[model samples]
Target: MTSILIADPIPLLNKGEQALLEGIVESLNIIFSKPDIMLLSNYPEKDARRSRIPVINRNPVLFKSIKKIMPRSAFLLEGALMAILARFGKQNFRRLFTRSELWQAFLNSDIIVVGHDSSVSYDAVIIGWLLNKPLVIFAGSIELFRNKLKESIAKVLLKKVNLITLREDDSYKALMDLGVIPGVKTQVTADAAFLLKPCSPERVKEITQQEDLPVHDRPKVGVTLTRQMCERSHQEINDVNERYKKAIAEKAIVLDEIIERYNVEIVFFPHCIGPGKNDDRLVARDVIQLMKRKDMVKPVVSDLGASELKGLIGQQCEVFIGERTHSVIAAMSQGIPSICITFPSDRRTHGIIGGMICQRDFIYNVERLNPIELLTLVDKLWAERPVIRKKLEGIIPLVKERALNSARLIQTIVSEKEKSDNGYRCPSSQH
Candidate 1:
């Protein structure tokens, strides 16, 4: 069997990350002949319970404690030392330095795959490179590093990667700016979530009833919120809390106006539940609590899986106004018209929504957020939804094919590795 390791630690609480992992796993299963797969997850026990595949904690307790104390430079230096020890030390020392099970999985794996959605991490890349493992980064939207140390590190580590399939043009451009050579090693692909299959209609209905979403005759407008959406950059604000509350209040007023003007039910999709204050559920609650038309608003408070959430949105929503990138992607994939609420730092919205899907008009900047402007955009989106939906129907299939192509590219990398290593044999074939 070809043992494959996904290096990123997926947290099920973040449905976008879950969607990426699910799509990648589904694609890999279809591409490979029952390949042995394992996940490195943040919530390993929970993920293991949900998935048939073996799950290991990406950050073990000891490592987590160590990272908390160590400065980033010191931490990275320690990782380098450990990698070197793992590469050249005695068996016992290697086991000690590599941190047991995590490194053991790294050593046993034929290929190391990193799924980068909104952000990029270089931990897996560094270790995988040191171990001489074939590494592929798929469906990534890599941002240009503002910090020089991170930029330098990215340049050094990324060059060693076997393949890098970016999800957006901005990421590709960022890679070029970082001086990573493109073409075969780097290619732009659509997000893996684009290929994620929604749950059955029956399951969707079950989730709808379970969440106690309104079953009224009015058209439903799906909305996704995040704490970040109500935040401005620290440079722009003195009192963050005050500004956030003000933003929430402003949003509440706008949503109330939207309800009254359009006679639409606003369904808040909690795209990310929590790890902290970043929870969409909390943000939605804050907005809903301040709104006058509470009866017209419903928040999906249940911690549902990515496919289930996608199904609910696809079946129920006529228009989506989403702060979460994947929520917008999910809605757009289903041929539903969506307005993307984007932060200044978010490259994904412009690159994916504007560049790929050609819906630049519907993307609104959160920094310069105006309630009247947002309401106007919503009105325009509502009016032009049919045409937008039609455009998406024409474009989404091609984008989905690109998403599937990422998996095919992985197969090619694996095939090339097999060809180059004559002494290596599949464990299943050996048996």
Candidate 2:
């Protein structure tokens, strides 16, 4: 059996990452002939073929404790906002985030697959380069888009790697222009997480049972928000807030109206529950409070497990407006159409829009947002979805195909790594 390793820095995953990782591990397990897969994550689970190998960390109990603290996570997320503020103020608050064991785990892996934007992969990429491991990456806005410096590092990292599994043709071509060679050796694969299986209707009914109300009776709506644009200078913030404030205001306005107009019950879901200003829980809290009535709306605040969240998304919710990339992905996989909101530079917008393949228009760009226009588009989409959904059924297979291609890449990587270990010639460095 070919052995492979998964390096995820954020040990305690928020819903989307967990679902993505699960699909990757399970698909590879089968395709690679039930390979012995070792995963080094902060939160490990016990499963059959895959072993959640624990890394050396002092006080696992404390780490677990820190993970469950929702408010604290929001506050810590604020530190990222602070850290960004510090970039301007020159404060350097990032030294607190380094985990020595994360890299140590990377050193032990045959291939290291990392999502973008985590401080863990920030170092993991370098470690892979230093160790000469086949470094495979699937990055875009969901992991936060790269800035100039990150782009620079990503360039070097992409070059140093044995293979580059890009998420989109745009990103793939960008790399190719910067000297990435494409062939069977270096392929453009889908976001491996897109292979996620939707929750069955029965499974969906089971998870929401704890919520009590009959599936049809509950007015279920999914809401997600990210405050990255808000952490900027007041002028920049105001510009974005003005553009999006109306959209947020409109979403609130429309949602408030939807609650009244449709007698719908809205459920706010915090996609990224990390520290301070970036804390989605706080943003959800802010939005919930901003809306008039607490009785008509609810926030599922438990930091749910992946399966639980996926089932929730699949449940016959009237609508799910995705504020995060994975939220849209989860919704689409479940045959639920979503209105995706993104910042100007969000790579995820392109990723999901591409996934939609013009089958169903489910994207809303937040930078140049016009709430009234967006609301108009939402109206048309809402009215047209029955027809739109049929279109989705046709394209779902294409999206699913891309996801399987990602698994193909992982299997190929594992095979190539095995060949290297057996002292075969290195897979001709086509990339």
Candidate 3:
């Protein structure tokens, strides 16, 4: 069995992250027949094992100690401190690298697959180098974090990765700006979740039945809203509460108008569910409370797997409007009309993905948002649903094909390594 270690993914919290993990596992299974795959997770062993997948708890001793003494409300501060340790300092960095469990996991893996959501950590890259193992970074955005020290360390460490696959144009440009690593093979591909198969007809039927979702004779819209648009844990905004109130009020108004004008029923889909402050379930309820016509909206809080939820959206909704990128991705993958409400700071990932799949006009920047403009676009989209669906039907398949290219690349790299180690040469042309 080819052992692969997946790093830097919290598979149990956000559904988008869950989908990315599932999609990569599916691809690896297809490529290696029987690969032994493990994940580095911040979640506890018992909780992480609930997925029935092998997981290594990645919280180092320092992190555990921090959590033990720190109050729950200071979680974000704890994260900032951890980030500093990971990037700024030498002592904590050595402590992380010297951890026996981390080194053991790194040494055991035949190949390391850094996840599809963010860049790999410097420690992970260093471990890969120390072991001389080939690493493939799967699809995701890649930009330097706010820490310049981290950026410098990452630039040096990333050079050792065998292949780095980027999922969107913005990340490609960001990588170019970061300067090319001499030996790393870089490729652009669609997000792996694009190829995620939908839930079975039976599963869809079960979900709708359980939720008592209206299937026909009425227009239905799926909406995903998160606290990400309104607040950040560490950042200070002028009158943050007032900003949230304004945004929430605007969203509620939009929802009400859409229902009033189009006679559409709205279902709020919670994309990220957990105990965290940014839990989508909490934000969904907050939005509902702020709405004038709360009766028109219902929050679906099921614990369905990622693909299953995507299937529900495909089967049940006429259109999807999401603040979360993956919810929009799910809708687009299934040929449903989708709109992404983006934050102004997100100049890359959101716009690039939506522009590539849907038209550029479908991407909305929240900072410059106009309620009337959005309502007009919604009405237009509804009017032209057939044409949009047809376009999506043509686009999604090609994107899926591109997604599979990442899997093919990993297979080729692994196969060549096995042959060379066994004293057999791969044909010169194959190189």
Candidate 4:
């Protein structure tokens, strides 16, 4: 069994994260005939198990204790290794506990497929390089979290990496600024989110009814809370509310206006939920209070799983207004036009634009947003919905195309390791 190890965000996390996880997992299982080990982190064995394919769920203890540790990646890897060791009878030593032990895990594997929507650990990248294995990063604006120092580290990691496959042109440029070299091997692919198909009418109807969503022929709008901020713990709710007050207030007004002008119906989608947090409810409550129309609908309050949530979004909206990139992704996948009201630090708007997407896809700096400008864009997007949908149809096919190409990059890197393990080529070293 040419074992390939997958490092991805698991579905139990949130809808956007789940969508990425589901898409990546299904792709690997279908594309690779070989039996593999998927090192599942942050989720339990039962939670990570699949239906048909056999996969080993390596339990880790350290990850459970990974709470705001300094040098986050080191802590993440340490936590994972400790957790894995605890599953056995062994105690984790501080030092094969060395990088060498981690290298062996990578070298023994035929390939390593990193996240399409996952947070790639520094350990994963470093060890993959040490093993001289093929390293491929599948994602959108994967650099969103990295700063200058981290970007330097990423450049070094890219040295032995086979490819850094980004779904957005702007992200590719972001990588270049960080030192990713330009070449045929450095791929700019479309987001895998587009590969998710629309739900069957029965399935859609089921979820729509289950969520208490409106299903009439009236024009509807989708509203997905920010996936990252949405899934934080209950303790974080007050913090988000205080921090993002202006943006939320601005958005509430936009929704109210759209409801008045277009008679908008909404599927109030929540992307993530931690132990006791309900961000969507908070958002939904705020929006409801702000609205002038009771006819503007909202989905019922309950934790909808990732698949069901996507189905609900797919069926309910003609367009979406979201804070999360993946929420916009859900809207995009369905050929439903969306506008991302982004945070100050987010570069996703630029990335989507690089793919030839227009400004209608996203707007940046919502924290200091001009209400008039935002409302104007909303009205304009509403007016040109059909034209935008037509363009998205052409864009949708690129999702799978990019994924397949990304898979090929990993295949080439893994194949080369069989010939020599002296050193691997850096992505920067390519043409």
**Backbone collisions counted per model:** 1, 13, 0, 8
Candidate 1 to truth, TM: 0.90
Per-residue lDDT for 258-287 in model 4, tens only? 788887676677776553453566667665
Q: Write the per-residue lDDT of candidate 2 for residues 253-319, one digit (tens) a residue.
A: 6667667655768777666665445567776676666677667776766655555666676674666
lDDT of model 4 at position 92: 38
Find the number of clashing residue pairs for candidate 4: 8
List lDDT for all candidates, in order.
Answer: 0.81, 0.55, 0.72, 0.59
Residue 176 in candidate 3, Cα distance off native in Å: 2.2
CA RMSD for every model?
Answer: 3.2, 10.1, 7.1, 7.2
lDDT of 4: 0.59
> lDDT at 155 for candidate 3?
75
Candidate 3's C-alpha runs over 4 A off are 45-52, 60-104, 145-147, 232-237, 422-431
TM-score of candidate 2 relative to the true fold: 0.73
Best-to-worst ranking by TM-score: 1, 3, 4, 2
- Residue-by-residue lDDT tens digits, candidate 3, 115-207: 467656555665555456677888767865699987777777778888888787777777677775445788887788787778898999998
- Supply the global lDDT for candidate 3: 0.72
Off by over 4 Å in 2: 41-108, 114-122, 129-132, 138-153, 182-184, 198-209, 212-219, 229-250, 420-431
Q: Model 1, residue 284: displacement in angstroms?
A: 1.4
Q: Estimate each model's TM-score.
A: 0.90, 0.73, 0.84, 0.75
Most TM-score-accurate candidate: 1
Off by over 4 Å in 4: 8-11, 34-39, 45-108, 114-118, 130-132, 140-151, 178-185, 227-243, 275-278, 353-364, 417-431
